[model samples]
Target: MSQSSQFSLLSQRRFAPFFWTQFLGAFNDNLFKTALMVALTYDALSWTSLDPGLLNNLIPGLFILPYVVFSATAGQIADKVEKGRLARFVKLLEVAIMLVAGIGWMTHTLWLLIAAVVGMGVHSTLFGPVKYAYLPQHLKPEELVGGNGVVEMGTFVGILLGEVAGALLVSYRPVGIELVAGASLTMALIGLAASWRIPASPAPAPDLRINYNFVAESMRNLRFSAQNRTVFLSMLGNSWFWFYGALVLSQFPVYAKDYLHGDHSVFVLLLTVFSLGIGVGSLLCEKLSGRKVEIGLVPFGSIGLSLFGIDLYFASQAYTNTALVDAFALLATPGAARILVDLVLIGVFGGLFIVPLFALIQTRCDPQHVSRTIAGMNILNALFMVAAAGVAILLLGQGFSIPDMFLVTALLNAVVAVYIFSLVPEFLMRFLAWLLIHTIHRVATVDVERIPDAGPAVLVCNHVSYVDAIVIGAASPRPIRFVMDHRIFKMPLLGWIFRTAKAIPIAPAREDPFMMERAFIDIAQALHEGDLVCIFPEGKLTSTGDMNEFRGGIAKIVERSKVPVIPMALRGLWGSVFTRDPGNLFERSFSRGLRSKLALAVGMPVAPQEATPEYLYEQVRALRGEWK
Candidate 1:
């Protein structure tokens, strides 16, 4: 299947049902929670003696508690059971929980509703691992970014829709009782219906014995995650995002009311802007990433989050009145442009930050324990969110304004980003790779459109310099998993980028037969699963400017996978700084803004049967065009 067609297939039974099922689940979660919040704020006198602020803080804490406590077990269950069946059952539980929420709403029983909220939290906790792990099983690796983008977009839009609905419906008083009961039940039914369409997802490790010791097992998962230093730190980076987000989101209600002097409608509008920003950013990830797990974007996201977050503080400083302002009024303020721009950038960078991390976790983690690792990440996310609330409470108690809190959070983000990237240099490495390819050279790619947009295909390119893969990556429209020399794969800084990109490292048959065989097997599997695989068939970087004889390895890959082979060529890189050209030791030759014009020319796909060293070489040579 072509990449576009494969993506379209996901909109069919195999994927769409699961997508909407998850969407509705997220939607209903926010719906009931928002309704409860409204009920507590406007009708708190009827529920309990607790202050709304305390309850607000307590509610988020209570909801996160299950993620911390139950994710370990949930991860186990997702691994042990069929995902489709588990999804349906979870939806059924949602129905029962929503019924409880209805009962609490009708009786105005805050305690009961809070319990139901906890129940929903537990449901989400269990669903977390399955929600992510399920994607690798159903979609092609090339589809990962697009699929994840859709999921993230759906989730945020669902939350926005749910909040809007909750605000409107909770105010509804049918026969003098809040109509939250009817709304919750109806949304639950819709979610259940969606779950019914989730196609079968057979368990990967169904016979694995259940581990009832949640603490020990959770710790084990965490330790396993830590074993892969890069993956582990990425998890931390992921968790920190939640912390950053929670702190920002927690202040919105207060910011709208106190700073902007807006009522409930303003609060909703602010959330809409934030959520819509996330949706836009998430959707853009697929495009920006070139359909790969582009970790380089993570640093970009962090930078924006911090910069915009600080700007937001200044934006809010311009506000002086307690009078209510609608969306238009808020936008009309002197500093509103900065605030709006910051919020939108924060969301955009957030999409860049998160999607790659999730993809990295999926692609890099052990297939057997991927779900468990995700669960462990979820636990950390829960902890970070809880801490965010606590930090916000502490800051507010210390007489810090919400805007000041945003500034503090923004500054802290820079510190955390520096620390995390320092520990796991892959983020920095990718940033370097991204920078080198994007800035150091102005690459013009031709015949890229000849590369199939979908299905399994082999890319044969001339290996010019050490950073050939990075350059190809930046030029190509789709992610291409490169087969690299084992030594280059182990380079100090470049190795991290290769590992994150899931580059297959190969040893020559004479050096390590086992490693060579494994590399071939990995390539075959990737192609079989419908991924774009690229190879430097010349085996090593060229000593001269001429392309070497293409090796039989390309033939071996195609013979096994029967995938189309697309020939590619890189020119004008021969005399570049990284190339083996003559240059003074301390002198930089191919610096950025030197007007160096790099070119990548691709050729039409050739049938596997017709693939040969000479034929492929000629195609690539032709694509390279006239070079100086």
Candidate 2:
């Protein structure tokens, strides 16, 4: 059954407890971490003589170090142990760390607080695999995107509120340290209470031998994940976001204080808008993706990230304010809102870029080894984030302003995005198809989930327009290898996309028997390898905006492959620009206007024995109805 919204999950036992646990963990971690950061930045003499600027970068770097050192073992433990029990233990550790941090607050022991930071880092590292791997066990496949979206939204909201709470609490008069410490301990206990309610998730790999040598096991985890090309690239892509985010977020305090000459509240404002932007974008993923893991958003997001990031540099450079002020006073200054907008957009786009990738990684990686794969991604994130800190430190050392780092990172983001997309053309190809459906057409799918999520299946659909494949691809949860007529498949712009999508082009036997035979061989091969291959059994687009004669090719292919054939039909696309409408291109498109409503209705899967061309033709015709 399709879930109404990602928020529906919060009401269920399976999801709510897990959500609260994760939310609280993020809140506690950031609350303490940000409180420490604010104290150091605004009250530096009491903390240490270390450059507050340098400490800002170094602190985040310190927090991620445990991800490098402990992720392998953590992944193994998560894979081998019951997740609910482990979560409780992790939360218990948080409580202990908070106890230590409470002492740091009361005694004014900077070293103790710093150690608590590292301890909290260890807590997060252990929880990382459990957090992601837990969802796949609980949620349905269709719910993965929405589930992930809600989790991300909750996490960032937690981080945002925590940062805000921490910033506000630490700066309180008379007993600021006491307030911060008390709140941290209280949150840690609440998180532990939440953990007890999490439903039990059995280990996928109970026999996984725990490896104590973190370094060797970490390499093994990386090597294992590297075996899957797409998954590995996605891991790298996921890590790159962290690199970009760390670079941006780490600079906010200094940027607020030194550049904008603003008080701590100004720093809180930056964190507020940016995290809120991410929360909004993350929740939108479910709606934008039609509840599927739509990775096309990755490219779309990267474009915005670079555009706004570049603008952020210019926005800051344009600001002339130098008087020290709080957030409200800073808002009154010229050019400040632009900086806020840029940061918000950057966060929004970052959400768009990341949430789908997380869903993709979860859905794509080996089921029994999800934790380890996540560990591999975490390792990459740690390395990249550490690199972000090092690079920022180097830039600042070389006399680069905070805005200079923004410009450099923004430009580098563009380069990195292009490089990753080039390596995986699927990202770019899906983006084009997604753009078409979202901008020009609004698509609804009927009984589409009847198509199997895995294994071999033959998709036979009526060809209604030139973009039938693109439309179908846009609606599908999985990539479909479309088999198109050689002529239409070779059209200029469409041809480029077809090639990138690895669409197979076939000619009629009368024209080129060799190509026809080769196409069948390719179809059989794809099915044998367990892929979804969609073919237009109508053999050609209907000239009258109706179903064409059923070609015998579908029967022959089904007989050979012995796989279920899903009969589908496109409706309400007959007079669209790509169709054989009785009008010029401009006229046909103008008639359709924007966001034209179209539907792809899929019927029950026909067994190989029952899937004759005639039977399948009637099935598709029935599904399409007279909408065309």
Candidate 3:
């Protein structure tokens, strides 16, 4: 695989057919919905006599209602049914619904079209579990992030095109409605065609006896999801994003017309920029995350989401334009570009926030129950989106402006983010480690895959700097439990990171025998539970840029745990700020260039019987070479 391997997956049969199948599904869904929304918002009297605000919130609510009512059942169906067949069946349902919608469009019957909306919602509800659960089965663990990013990019791009198609097709003279109807039906047929090409995906739970009770199954699904604390909170975080998004996105039509003084075309422009931004951010996840499911991007994304969301409010306040204008004319206005940038950035950050969470959920959830877990999340998403609508109605009724809603959502995002991070400090810890490598040092790993993916193994690395654990942890695909000197846990900020990572803090035998004994027990337990534990055999940071004599402690660990030892080396990290730099703290901070070139080289795993201290020392030294 090349650096751009994510794009290359599109050429293979395993991923491409599914990609286009869902892409067209999204396109057709949005094509129908956006056309109806634009027509209703722009020319409401012709479509219905109802207030536009009620209709705006009501439409989305109707669409999301099925997720709450049917998602559990849908998840059960996805798990029990073969995926390719299910996908094709769902597409056929889409074709039938679009035909009904086409009829409603020609007749101008709002109720029929609204029913079609509910039907499409059912279609999506059925497909939701299949859409996500399918990826983990088809792609390698490393590919999940890139696969998800590509899918997300395709979904958003489809949405962008669909919204554009809806707006332009429905705004044309004489037969705009007919054009929308024809185009939606045609896309539905094309999506159905695409679905037929998808390869068979075996059901994970063919024997699962599905319950028909929505309330009961919904509870069961949530119970299964909540069984894992991190997965559960992640589900909530995922749902909260929808809440934030619904509040922000649902306001755009009105935000465009009433606040920005722009026409329906301007609404299209806003949606366009936002979707395009999400596409760019989604694609960037693979590159930014080093092609792994780095949840650190979650915090990074949350920060950007809140910042841009608040700025959007200010940007809207700064705009003084009062005359109605088209998209082109609005762009030429003084303050419009700022608003555009804010929307795009919000979308970009939104992509960063969401893709990793999805990947994490997939990787972390129970394999057999992936569909139900996703279904549970979908239910939560629906609930949050509904709550967003309620919040919008309540706030708007209380005289809050759309921009006020944006500000409130952004602030709430920060509060929720802090709460979630506090509950799971690993997200924050990983963020710090990821930040260190990406910012302080450029990290390259050689043969790093030799570190076991799924078994307990002892990783022995040279201790050259104070932040060696952080660098190694960030580089490993799976989590590592580090055994380090207990005193390092007393440092101010770094202490928090290590403690949050659940690093086993140890003391020298001569200093604190009790703590030393307890440390070995903890290491034994971690290994028995099948976790990767790394110990710096040098036992302390190097003072003279040379390896300390091999310590007996590693031999003791191997004897106790009886796991293979993987010797690793860190190169070019001796005189950095985090090391024993000769300069004072202030001077050491920047005297040498702060950023260092670092490489983590992993050798083949040594058998437990042969991983003696003296042998591993030579192995690590040979790997480190003269880079220091």
Candidate 4:
């Protein structure tokens, strides 16, 4: 297995089925909901309640209620059952629910249709844990970012499609209600077919007994999540995102109609822009982070969310009556560019904010307990969404315009972000670490292309600085899972970044025999599964700024796995701030550069049969342009 093939999108079976399953599910969900909402909104006079606003508010509440009520139990069920089976069952439930929705549509029964919406919410709550937990199981740690990217993209695009389909189909009065009912049924059936194809994911804990006490079990799940401070904080940050998103998005219809003076089409246009922005941002995450779960992007996302959110308020203020405007008209309006920019940036930052957090939760949580932990997070997400509605209602009651609510939410986002980052400095800390390497240092490469473009390969690099892993990470086009010393894995801020990056922590036999063995086994499994496994062969940082004796660990790994070994060298980093060399505390001259030139050189791959420490050493030193 080569490094390139390890990270290739189409090569892995772990991802594709799950991707389509979730995508179709999301698409169907939005399609049904949007169609219902549009029907209710446009034909309010024909419905029982003349107040479209009240029905709108009530619908979201009804949908979210199930998440709050059932998520904890759903988590437990997912843990105890085979995830693939569970997913199929849930999709089947979706078909049944949509059928009920179709009946309601045909009969013009709003309440029955609303019940179906609630059912879909429950379906989503149950599927939520399975959706996230399944990823860590099948995906290599290195593929987490890209896999999540695709999932996120599919989800948003599905939402956009659903919204468009719902609005358009519900408005089409061909044969009164028959056409809408038929369209809904067809989409639901297609979604079920997609779900059926999800490959078998064996249950993680088949012997686990069911916990019927929802409150107590829910509390237990939350407490279990709290045990990992970073994971818990990530959940909180994630919840905050839902809170922010719900508040902003809930007002879109109003903003479009009241402020932009457009019809439902404008509402759809706004949603399409936002959803497309998220898809683009999500896909870009893998490229930007070098295919790692880079938490640094979280703060970057937060900053953009706040800045663009504030700017959106000003843009809205500049809008005059612009009703019935198509996408082009919206673009050409006086403040249109700013509004569009803000919406797109919000989506971009939202993607940045979300993808890493999901990866962090997946990688950091106990695998056995991950599904339940996600369930707890879903519960919080439900609460936040509910709270968003409550807040919006209160603001509207106080005579605030929808645009004003957007501004308030944007400002509040800044405050919440600052508070959360202050509490859990890992987000800010990773930002610092990411900044240090990318800005002050310009890493140059010689023979980087020597690293095999595909197949399983072991990277043996001479460790020099604390950030050796990050340097290698930045240089490689593909993601590499590092096998690091356990002690370094416990480093203050650096430890969190490494863990989130899914770097496997190892110890020498003398320190922790069991952990060491597990590390080696994991390495072998990763290789057999065709993943890039990188190790600092010197085992520890070079105290004298020179390569140390290469351990036989790399040799042993290759002997067992028969993977190629790519030797790498680092230079121009011996006296940097991260290095061991003593320097003036306040007047460090080495770290002060806009882009300091650094080098990462790669040597030709040594076959498993021919690899030797002495030969690889000479190759690395030669590539480094120096000898010691």
Candidate 5:
């Protein structure tokens, strides 16, 4: 769970070379794009007669055009071909394209340069599926989040460095153009060199026949991706992030110039701030998630994005001055620092928002279709970015200010978050679990690995308090279905949370015989389907913070569908507010308040035949002995 362990992947041949290969690709793309953008926007050259506005917009469209047109075919190619070999080929193509781009830069040949842009777009489209799909093939499930964080951090860092390098190199008079060309070519070659060191990854589906008809193939890939509910929704969330990023970034130049009244250096400063924030945030994800695929960060990230975005709108509503300022002067300005902070926070929150979703998609999707699924995600991302541009144009045409646009996008983000969370309540449930552990207690879990990583299992624990299930669920790496008293499941606000978590509600036969029977049936089916079912053998929370006699309901469960039973103990929460103390549950819930310490100890799994109610009770009691 340490940061070094997460970062040690850098020293391994399995990850490092692929990391640089991707890094160089991203660097080259931004390098060329920035050079072209500066050339078009600032009248750095008189090579073309087209309107600057038209060219400025046309460039982004041309670059992303391939993602829409060729991503499906690219996905199939990734699946059918060996990845290491394909990556080298892609890098070689980048070198060739850069060579052509260099010639265009030297001669100021607009068409040639534009062709290079389109070529890079295709290169990216081909590599897109390979980038994400490569990780799961090489890294373990627990290492995925950290690995992805490193990759994302490297990508954004490359982008930032490329943009800065391009802008600086372009500013140096006549030799500037040649330097841009040289840099692109040099980076491409370096990328090719790095790609050579990547270890081999055989084709996942060598028999998948090529289908050149991109339109129909794209639809098919989309359909394939949609078949998995969580993966597809994750794709939608990823696309929405792109949409939000595109809208915010597309306005930076104008916002910097007209609103902040800053010069080019100031614009670079803004980019640097946001870029560094993302790099830091992305790297921080590994530690925040404790080296797991923790989606709780998603909701946390969304909330920060909305809050900061809205604040940014208000922060930039009135600039301190209308006169242009250099980077230093801009920082020195009274209110300018707030704008910069907001930008940085927005980027930080964005990094937090995106990394988990990417990891989730890679790990959750079918192994065979990973590349194609990524291709589908790329296609959707392209469409969302394009739609983002269109929406920006439409709103700007209506004479809205950039700040107003930010506000609108912020509001739209809130709406999108709510919609997605509703569709997959696990996100919200995880958030709640994460919140409970983070705010209410510092939960230390031991031997949580005893819980099966996959397949059917029965988790037997001594129920200590009302919040015991949430704590256990949060600490567990895999999802759990808890069997709780129907009354607690029907509690006011807590009821909805339990239902969303898919917790089974059980009752005594005397209270509701039909419900009790239905609960047992659900438990058997869940176990039959290879899900993890957690049941408190005592069948109720401890009223006196002591052990209760084991119930026969657990025996009924094992009789119906036997599975490995993991014995666990809750070693804290004796007097916490959620416990049934001297007063009502509500009155005692926050008695220990914030930062209360707790521990959950999971014992070795007992075989189904040996896992009687009494045995599990004794195991849990032993585990909890001293603390209890």
Candidate 6:
């Protein structure tokens, strides 16, 4: 019920417990892992005869392997049981694993500790599906973006804090070891308490038979994911982000040590900057997207990712320091701030790229299969991360510098983004609409919520510019299928965008009678399928920046579909670049500088019987208030 912001959800019963429970789980995992890393690095010869390098490499693999093996089965389990109870069960499992880990710590038993590591991995694999799917069930659709941002922020903060705790606490000798054990157990218990407080979330698929066969069930989930093309690709985008993240984050210590000539303090600074960037970027999504699942941010984020990623390489090259420095000394070095800013921007873009994809996955997928779909994505994420490791290894083996690796990853991001956007132009189309509104105009909407949130609706708006449909599309929270003039739909750069958007192209009866007929059929079908269809009832852009005679197509549309007719108007777009300003577009481009201010007003819906083109025209004109 709270639409004001996602921060309000933290005070409510449904989300607060889950947020803390998840945060504690992340914290405990990192704490244990960091403790093990410290033990291996500082005291490996004392604890065991094994090589530290081997353990360093093996531990990450150990943690990720369970995701590959058990995520499918985990998804099925999430769907078959109540989430609150399962979360509590998982938390208890954590306590048991930490107890074993505490013993391993006290006894200095490497094998037992390694087993504990795998157990923690299994615990995480089980929780992955529920972690994502749980939010959609409890939060309102509009609240999803903010909810995910907070979750991501919490996860990163926990990782940072846990790492610091493990490293610092383990450095104080025997007391430090004892502290590590105590902290892990205490955090596990706290997490269990938090989970116990989570409200019951009923299973979406209660009657579905449980499938114990991991491989078969995994395939079934993958199949379910494939049924929706957009959701599946969004999952792939999500996984690719993990690949990019793992590769870049894993390299920070080495980059700090070898390239920047900095000590542990510098490494921590780099990691901290990156994590904070992601947190800031994640939080910005709710504001930038207007509290909707806006895929446009995906492309924007990717662009920033690639751009800053390349800049990082150059920034690293600018670092002239050769002697090892502490965090403060590193800050004193020339270009250090630039390198740090690059990391932060990369993180910010990474957050932008990822948060929307997760929200889109949750909001777009089938409710019953959301967990399974997320599980499938987890499996792929694990695979991509493994592949990323291989890529890093191969590149490093070839004697490439860490900065060069950063460059390669940034270029790869751009290539992959272009390919994916080409395959599904919706991402690119939305980006164009989003970009136009963001760059070319400052859009303010009044009573846009008057448009129906669900079911079919005929949106009749006055046409003011060639880009009116795109402006309206960007302003509306929901997607709009615009019926456009066939000629404009066939012209140059804008044509490609129109086609990608799947816009319905229409023509006058004298020019193309069949096209007009098909356009009407498409409108009827779109309305029947509960889509929002927007038509310029004036049938053409006003050549004189005034309303044209209202056409009859809207009458035929409402007569056939009989949906609610919402009257809307775009004000203050006349005489702009996309308008017939002094004859033809492109004559006065950027005359108003970047970000021209504009407003859209939405009037109440008229009954279908009263939804004549003339009536809608007058309503739109009333809202417009002589802006033209």
- Which tens-of-lDDT digit does each residue in 317-416 have in candidate 6? 8888898898899888999999999999998998899999999899888888988888999898888887877787778779888899899999999999
lDDT at 144, model 2: 95
lDDT of each: 0.82, 0.93, 0.91, 0.80, 0.87, 0.86
Over 4 Å off, model 4: 1-13, 174-177, 322-324, 440-569, 573-628
Q: How many clashing residue pairs, candidate 1?
A: 2
Task: Estimate, for each residue in 247-356, the C-alpha lDDT of model 2 and write its tens digit.
Answer: 99999888988999988899999999999999988988888999898999999999999999999999989999878889999888999999999999998999999999
Residue 178 deviation, candidate 4, in Å?
3.5
Which stretches in model 6 have alpha-carbon errors above 4 Å?
Answer: 1-3, 41-44, 47-57, 583-593
Residue 524 CA error for candidate 6 (Å)?
A: 2.2
Candidate 2, 362: how far from true, in Å?
A: 0.7
What are the runs in model 2 whose C-alpha is more than 4 Å off? 1-3
Give a tens-digit lDDT track for model 1, residues 299-372.
88888889888888887787565666777787776666677777777877777788888888887788888788
TM-score of candidate 5 on Cα atoms, chains taken together: 0.96
lDDT of 4 by residue, 1-628 (tens): 5544323554455666677778878887787777776777767767676566556656776778788888899988988998888988888888888889888888889888889889989888889999999988888777888888878888999889988877777777766367667776787677677666677788888888888788888888899999988899899999998888878876776677668866667778888888998888888888667666788789988888888888898888887754567656776777777787789889999998898899888987888988899999998999888888888888888988887888898899999999988877657756765676678887676777666545689998888888888877767655578899899877887788777666899998899999989999999998987778899888788877888888778777877898889988888877677777666744545455567777888888888888877777777777777631
lDDT of 1 at 279: 85
What's each prediction's clash count? 2, 0, 0, 6, 3, 0
Can you tell me which runs of candidate 1 are displaced by over 4 Å?
1-10, 172-177, 436-469, 473-568, 572-628
Tell me which of candidates 3 and 6 scores higher on TM-score.
Answer: 3
Better of 2 and 3 by lDDT: 2
Q: Worst lDDT window (10 residues) for model 3? A: 587-596
- Please state every model's RMSD to the true fold in angstroms: 6.6, 1.4, 1.4, 7.8, 1.9, 2.3
